[model samples]
Target: MSAFDPVLSADTVDQILHLYATRGDDHYGEDVSQREHAEQCAYHARIDGADDALIIAALLHDIGHLLHKFGEDAADRGIDTRHERIGSGWLARCLPPSVSEPIALHVAAKRYLATINPSYLKGLSAASLQSFLLQGGLMDAEEMTAFLAHPAHQAALDLRRYDELGKIVGADMPAFDSYAPMIRALIMKDAR
Candidate 1:
């Protein structure tokens, strides 16, 4: 069954989240469930004073990881899975570009981060580093200038940071339902 309809009602959001109730980045070496990571990212975004839109984006950023039936170790098997694009495309139907844009661009943001700062590469977790290599190591010279100018560049980078930070295990935070108001309101007023 589809977790969401043409428009995202609150109930559908919960159904979508159910995909996370059972799994997350476990095979990728993260200790948190998908639900926890989403909650953590949203919580951090809220604390960082992001507006409701970005917070909702953060909360739902990795929902693609849940929707696909990829093996937990898909990256290990050399499958990129392209969760960013999948999640963003699925979300674009119900979310504004303010949210879906960041979700779509975050992986590119990681590649962008690696190009600008070598130290940033050092900070990536094992699985992240592995996927980074698969996604594209560093942007080439011409790509560098263009990537820097992308309008979604900054939001993608910010979401990437939250994506990494949200993986910490065993944290207590509000559940998915806690953001229902934001989720309900921030969805595209006109469904795409």
Candidate 2:
């Protein structure tokens, strides 16, 4: 069964949690599981004083990887998977643009950063490096200019930074449930 209903409800939070609890152990070419990466990213966002919406965005940023049937190693086989679009589309059913837009643009933010800061490219993980190529390699001046005009540009970049830092093998982080209240509140607020 799918993790989410076609419409939003109280169970929406549970469905997301169930996804993390069940398939979150799958890796995305990193040492940590999907759940671990999410929690750690969220932890960093919270510590960095991100607003609740951005924190939730950080937590669910990579959810596209979990939502799809593509094996965790899709990037290894030279497939882009487009998890950012998938995740953002799925999340837009209930989440505000504040959350979903950042999730959608995070990969773009990566490309933007790597284009402007060559050293940023050196810091990407092996898996991220592969996917980066598949995700358009680098942004030219035109692309960078367009990316800069996006209202969510800064937030997306912030989430991308947290994403890079979230892949530790073992880091102290809160569990998914710890953020459920925030998630639920966001959902309810958006639904209204």
Candidate 3:
């Protein structure tokens, strides 16, 4: 996918929102709805000073879950139908690497975190744990070694952090509007 193709336009965001609004009711686990989760991710990314692409990535990361119709069983089956891969591919058609790569890497980040932080693994659901192994098992020592060689490691790490914190359930969750300007600024800057 060309970097320019994946750049989120107003229509793209609208399509995403509509997709979530219609399907958000079918959530599998956790009290937070999909829309709520996206908002939380975007909010946290902004708070962490993430670039616009990263913020958009956070907001749209899990959209695959809604888009692909995967259930907890499929997610747990270690099936290649993992939402990250699916979502990243879909996003790649419309957005740039700045957005798509992190979404693509977020699942790997989950595995990476699971390997390094025992506590992180402990917090995962049984399905998530199984899927983690199927997805790559902390990416293997060799893969991890190679992954760490990249400059984007820190950005991927930060995206992972936002991914985790974004799942909280509560009325107190931050709003998405607050981060819209930042997202716009980032996209505009990238366009330049």
Candidate 4:
């Protein structure tokens, strides 16, 4: 049961920014860049009163997609190389449970959404939809029941919420600065 650590350093959110800079090559769906998604997730997490660690997790949970080179069609390949698993595994080595758990569980969030919310499933991209089934669509009733019962369930759910709303077309999204406070707070919280 190893814990997760963030690859980004507190001295600078450069890693995230770098990821954003390459959004053109990376982003999977909705035409929203990676940077845009991070900011949006952080913004919504703050508004929803998530704790500092949770906020940072919201901003960075998808980072695994970038770091692992999972590509945009990860869900479509039917390969089980889930970005969440990769990202969560990487984070566990550097970050604390507060940050890593949500990231690790975000994939489960996708499954949960597909199962419980019709509207949620409708919003998924084609690749995301296919990957969803590939990941674990065949879970038996017992497995589904057990998955939702995990401790990180709520965190995964919230992260998913932010992930969905993070997509924006042109403008009207929160600035990156807004996330600074939350990131700082999370770092501090993890340190303490």
Candidate 5:
């Protein structure tokens, strides 16, 4: 009921999902709702044969945005929101590194992709492209070199790729309840 209720639990996941269901409708310039984007990203991950943890990472990557007090379109206010850090910090407690690491690096993955792949940059949706600007723009050569060497680089890049592809509007996809079991399995015992 509260914004990110300071606790990691099954109920927290439910509250997060409920936030997505209730408040995820505004994607700014995009066609899909925030929840739709999440589900489609997860769907793309499954279709691409990603393992369960990676799939879960794809599904919940933008949760920071949902958890923000400013809501999904917070970037509109010139605030960075830093959803990746916000989401990933809470997530690190609830999930294993396999899931949280890539999430923490996702925006870095975006910046990295933009610098290394011109076509990928060109292919971004207007909203993503705009956020890309607010997201710190393209990585510089030094930053790119460092990012490429990070351990989670590949996984984050994969997450970025699935993220790009997940923007399909009106896509038929599974609901969050379908993912409850896997998410619960992945949650740490202390958290649950």
Candidate 6:
């Protein structure tokens, strides 16, 4: 398939799974592959008792990185791929706002946390820190205020935390296919 064919064609659960199975091995500068990071994030969300949508949001948050033409080291090259927007935009077509909005806002959530909690920046992984800088570093006062006003801001923050918790080099994680049932159910419900 072409570079973006998978992303452009993936509007259903099966296709989305295929996208991951095909492209998830690229680690995107992190210690874990995209699939591993996604599984770990979902695991963290579930352990924290997040709702279904939030869990799915956590699992798929960085999907845009796979969908883009930019190589995995876009951040290293000082280009912000804006994976949040691309991933969220794609998911919005199949899921409700409950999932997509948080994915969209998660980067902003990171920026917000960095601005409000100095210690938060210290916990970020090297790849995250690089992307964080490319993603506009810290939020200013007005940006923080605006971010706070978004209805899904809290969930976004939660997803951001999970995102950071993922990326363990060799953590045991469930297979990516395990989420297929939940994703299929969500797609079916949203189609109704």
Candidate number with greatest lDDT? 2
Candidate 4 residues lying further than 4 Å off, grouped into runs, are 1-14, 22-25, 73-80, 177-181
Query: Could you give candidate 4's per-residue lDDT for residues 38-137 as a string of tens digits?
Result: 7788888889999777788887887777776656665555566677877777655545677888898887878877777777788787656776777785
Worst lDDT run of 10 residues, candidate 1, spans 1-10
Give the Cα error of residue 22 in candidate 3, in Å: 1.0
lDDT per residue as tens, model 5, 13-126: 777668777776757358888788888889889999998889999988988877778755566766778889888877776577778889999999998888888998998888
The positional error of residue 84 in candidate 5, measured at the CA in angstroms, is 1.0
Give each model's whole-structure lDDT: 0.77, 0.89, 0.71, 0.71, 0.80, 0.87
Tens digits of per-residue lDDT, candidate 1, 16-69, equal: 656655564444347777788888898888888887778988998887777777
lDDT by residue for model 6 (33-81), tens: 9999999999999999999999999999989988998898777788998
Candidate 2 RMSD to the real structure:
3.3
List candidate 1 segments past 4 Å from native. 1-14, 22-28, 188-192
* Sort by lDDT, top down from the best: 2, 6, 5, 1, 3, 4
* Per-prediction TM-score: 0.87, 0.94, 0.79, 0.78, 0.87, 0.92
- Tell me which residue pairs clash in candidate 2: none
Cα-based lDDT at residue 161, candidate 2: 82
- The best candidate by TM-score is 2
| True-structure RMSD, every candidate | 3.6, 3.3, 3.2, 3.5, 4.0, 4.5
Specify the poorest-scoring 10-residue window by lDDT in model 4: 1-10
Each model's total of backbone clashes: 0, 0, 5, 8, 0, 0
* Native-to-model Cα distance after best TM-score fit, residue 163 in candidate 2, in Å: 0.7
Off by over 4 Å in 3: 1-10, 76-80, 125-127, 174-192
Model 6 — TM-score against the truth?
0.92
* Model 1 TM-score on a 0 to 1 scale: 0.87
Residues 28-81 of candidate 2: C-alpha lDDT, one tens digit per residue: 578999999999999889989999999999999999999988898798788899
lDDT of 5: 0.80
Superior by lDDT: candidate 2 or candidate 6: 2
Clash count in backbone of candidate 6: 0
